[model samples]
Target: MVNTRDLRVIAVLISLLFTAFFVLIILFRGEIDTAATATVESYGLVAIFLGVFLLELLPQYISPHLLVINAIFLGFHIVPIILVSILGHIFASLLGFHLGKVYGFRLVEKLYSDKTVSKISSGMDRYGRWIVLLSAFLPFPYIPVIFGSLDLTWKNFWIFGIIPRAISFALLGFGLSFLTF
Candidate 1:
């Protein structure tokens, strides 16, 4: 359904968006960090939930890891932070899944080389749910796109994607909680 022209246009748009995000971060690093920290402190868990949700929805567009670490440093408990982070990831995955369903192939092609997409597709077929579970914990942000492109069922996505993502977040939260300075 997607053509080369459409893929090129989407790729350009995505690249521009990332460039703009990086530019903003570079230009406003101090102010952004201070504002983010203050906002989390003032609003508490709601801020964390919303922040993580947006980060997950956009993935590498922003660093949610720093946000969560900052939230923990600002005195949010690990349990609630983990819960909210997982919830955000689930919601983000749902969005990505649907997006992939509609435009998975084109997006994947734009994001990865044709050979890479082929390899991933073959691996998904061979590994099935296990791949989904494993991908949940991986740092790679393309997992949801791959799953959606494969047309993976909702049940498998929730089970494999959400569960491992929650566990990973819990571990990350617990580990980060112990850091000093």
Candidate 2:
């Protein structure tokens, strides 16, 4: 069964992954920026839509915010970018949550024993709201399957996960509007 220690270790590992990703972005900013520019030039807003959708939908350990930031810095209009981002995030959230709802428990059970699953279920029962909300707002994994396997209600997930995430993207989009360079 997964214990508190295991959870802590997982947290640390995720933190390290985000840190590594940021470091890589800083180190390869020029290359990444160039590629992003090329992508936007080649595909236009479709690129933004797909980038945000895929990044948020998949377990790629990359943030969709990067694409948004790039679009802003590339001189795209903020309103359309934010609108597309919200759509992408919302669609991804819906699919991810449904996937979790449908397949999360079975997949998790295959990986972990029944006892562990039971314990996890109970823990989720106790703290699923906080977990969902935290994952939504924080830079955590943001995997909706965990929310689904844990049995978070759709209402709770919508309120905590979808709304907060959309707001975050909108806020980031607007906030980046102020950047001069």
Candidate 3:
């Protein structure tokens, strides 16, 4: 029978999966955009807030246009975008970590226990903090998902998580800002 820990893991998994799908929608412009831009500043702010919430609750970052939204609103400065993404992702990862530790690793192990993931998890643990940085810098599909799947330590997650993600985000912002240059 499923217990509270099982339920917690399930909830987190559901949130992550949902975020993945939402990221796809954002990537493909699948959502209706008719009233998106014309909407008031408050609407835009609300959207950003929601995006941040998703990042906190899920493992997808920069995938669902979170970085882009920040870049758009805060201007194309690499610093702000990087800072925001790093902080956002760090917090998200930490939240997941605490949940896993408090609830127990059994739930995470059960959910993410595919053959390939087994190998990935081992490698991730072996590499330790470095993995966080790499995951942060690398492109999507694997990074965030793996982090949540593995149920890493919050402290390690923040240290390794912040550097690469924040830097990559800065790079994106600067690149976009320089488009006219």
Compared with the true structure, what per-residue lDDT tens digits does model 2 show for residues 1-181? 4565675676578658756765675567677677766766667578778878887775535678877876676667899999998898888878877877899877655444465456546656777687567666777656665577777889998998889888988999999899725
Q: What is the lDDT, from 0 to 100, of the residue 159 in candidate 2? A: 91
Top-down TM-score ranking: 2, 1, 3
Each model's backbone clash number: 0, 0, 0
Best by lDDT: 2
What are the runs in model 2 whose C-alpha is more than 4 Å off? 1-42, 108-126
Candidate 3's residue-wise lDDT over 79-152, tens digit each?
Answer: 54445555555565556566656655455554444443565577687986676676566653334445655666
Tell me the TM-score of each prediction against the true structure.
0.64, 0.69, 0.56
* Per-residue accuracy of model 1 over 1-54 as CA lDDT, tens digit each: 446566667657866775676567556666766776677556767766777677
- In candidate 3, position 127 carries an lDDT of 87
Stronger candidate by lDDT (1 vs 3): 1
lDDT of each: 0.69, 0.73, 0.53
RMSD for each of the candidates: 5.8, 5.6, 7.1
